[model samples]
Target: MKALMTLALVSTMAAGLAGCVVAPNSGSIYTSRQAQNEQTVRIATVESVREVRIDKGNSGTGALTGAALGGLAGSTVGGGNGSVAAGILGAVAGGLAGDNVEANMKRHAGVEITVRLDSGELRAITQDADELFRPGERVRLLSDGRKTRVTH
Candidate 1:
C-alpha cells in the first residue's frame, strides 16, 4: 500500500512538471533626440516600421526536478526487468513534462523598422524630419550639411 501511494505521488509530480516555455512579445520603437541643422530642407523617407515585443515569462523548474524524482521512484519500484522498464518510462514522461513547461513559458512577438535617406543638396534647416512618422518606424538620415535631412 505504501509503495503504491509513493508511486502515485511520483507519477503525479512528474505529470505536473512537463510544461514550460515563455512566448516572446512584439518589437518596439527607437528614437533619436539629435537636432537637424537649422535651415536645412530635410527630406524624410519611410524606411521600415513594425510592432512591439511581447514579454516572455519564465517557466517553472518544478518539471525537470519532478521528472528526475519520478524516474528515481520508478526505478526503485521493482527489481530487474521491472526496474529498467520503470526508469525508461520515467525519463520519457519527464522529458514530456519539461517540453510542455517550456512551451507554456514561450513568448512570441517582434517587430523591425528600417529607414533610408536620399542624397541631394538644399538648405540647412530642421524641417519636419519625420513627417508622417508612424510609431515603430525607424527613420534614417543622410546629410551633406548643405541641404536635406534624408530620412529613410
Candidate 2:
C-alpha cells in the first residue's frame, strides 16, 4: 500500500542519515587532507589502554530529514484541519526522535591510549577502537600536529 511504501522510504532515509554520522577515523584510514602530508612518527610503548566512546556531535541532518518524512506521512492521517495538526505533531516528535537517533549513531567505540614516548614523555591519545593495543606494547604514534593516531 501507499502507507507501507512511505514507511519504507522513511526507514531508508533514516538509515542513510545514520550512515552519514560515521566517518573514517580509524588508524588505517586516511583523509584526503591527511594524504600526501608529512606526519611525525615516534616510537612509544603503551602504558595503558581504556575503552572510550567518541561522539562527533550532530549536524542537524537527521532531524531535518526525519521531520520532512514525518510531516509528509502525518499529512495523510486525516481531514484538512486535523491533518495539519497531525503533521505538526509528527514533525516535532520525529525531530526529537531523529536527534536522539543521530546522537546514538554518531557515537563510536574508541580507546584512550596512554603511551610513554622514547623521549620519556607521557601522552594519551584517543582514537577509534579499530586497532588493538595492549599495555607495554610497542606502537607507532603518527602525528601531524593537528591529529594523532596509534598503529602497530
Candidate 3:
C-alpha cells in the first residue's frame, strides 16, 4: 500500500515537472524580451531547408524531482540499513532516468533555412520547424541584430 502510494506520488511529480519545460523557439513565438522590440526586416529567397533537432538542454528540475521521489519510494523498500542503500541506489538511477526523460522531451524538431538576401549575401537561420520553407520561395528575414528568423 505504501509503495503504491509512493509510485502514484512519483508519477504525479514527474508529470508536474514536465509542465516546466521551456517553450518552443518558433518564428511565431517570442520571448518577453523579444516582444515590443523593433527588428530589421529584409527580403530573401530560400535556397534550401533541412530538418534539424533542437535541444533546449536540461534545467535540473527533472533530475532533482526524480531523485527526491525515488528516494522516498526506495526508502520504503526494506528496513534499516537495507532501506538506506536502496534509497541511495534509487536516487542515482532515478536521477539518470529523469535527466534522460527531460532531455528527450525538450528535444524538438527544427529547420535549417539557407537563404539569399536581396543584397546577394547568403545566410542560414535555424529555428523550430513551426513553418515550412522551400527553395525558390520568397521569405522575410527578421532580425534584431542578434537573433534572426525566417518567415513567409
Candidate 4:
C-alpha cells in the first residue's frame, strides 16, 4: 500500500512538472525608438479576436514516469514470477494511460489575432492570450527569422 501511494505521488509530481511551459508574451518595452534588426516590425490594425487553443505536443515524460510508478505498484501485488509478469503488464498499461492524460493536460489556452497590415495584407498569429486585445486596436507585429508575435 505504501509503495502504491508513493508511486502515485511521484507520477503526479512528474506529470505536473512536465506540463509547465515558459512562453513569450507581449509587453511594453520602453525604448528610445524601435531598434532595427534582421527582424521586421510592422504596424497593423486588429481585425478580429478569436479564441484559440495550442497543443504543447507531448514528449513522453508522462509515459516513462508512469511506467516506473506502475511497475513499483505491481511488484507489490504478488510474489516471484507472478510479480514480474504483473509489473511488466502494469507498466505498459500505466504508460498508455499516462500519455493520454498528459496530452489532455497539455492543451493550452490562446487567441488567434487577425490583423490587416498597412500594405493591406491580412495575417493571423496565434499566441498565449494572457493580455486582452480588441478589434480595431493598433498593435505591432514583430517577426524575427523564426517566430512572430503581436504586441500592443
TM, every model: 0.33, 0.85, 0.84, 0.73
The per-prediction tally of clashing pairs is 48, 0, 0, 0
Which parts of model 1 are misplaced by more than 4 Å?
A: 1-46, 50-70, 73-80, 103-106, 117-152
Greater TM-score among 2 and 4 belongs to 2
Worst 10 residues of 2 by lDDT: 15-24
List, residue by residue over 55-141, the lDDT tens digit for candidate 4.
887867777776766777687788999998998988898888777877877786789999999999999988877777899999998
lDDT of 1 by residue, 35-149 (tens): 3434433344454455434335444454555566567667877889999799778866875675565545454443443344355322222332223445344454544454333
Q: Kindly state the number of residue pairs that clash in model 3.
A: 0
| Per-residue C-alpha lDDT of model 3 across residues 39-147, encoded as one tens digit per residue | 9999999999999999888887777777767777688799999999998988888888877777788898999999999889999999999998999999999999988
True-structure RMSD, every candidate: 12.4, 4.2, 4.0, 5.6
Question: Each candidate's lDDT (Cα)?
Answer: 0.48, 0.85, 0.85, 0.76
Candidate 2 per-residue lDDT over residues 33-99, each given as its tens digit: 7899999999999999999999988888778767767777787899889988998988888878877
Q: What pairs collide in candidate 2?
A: none
> lDDT (0-100) at residue 6 of candidate 1?
72
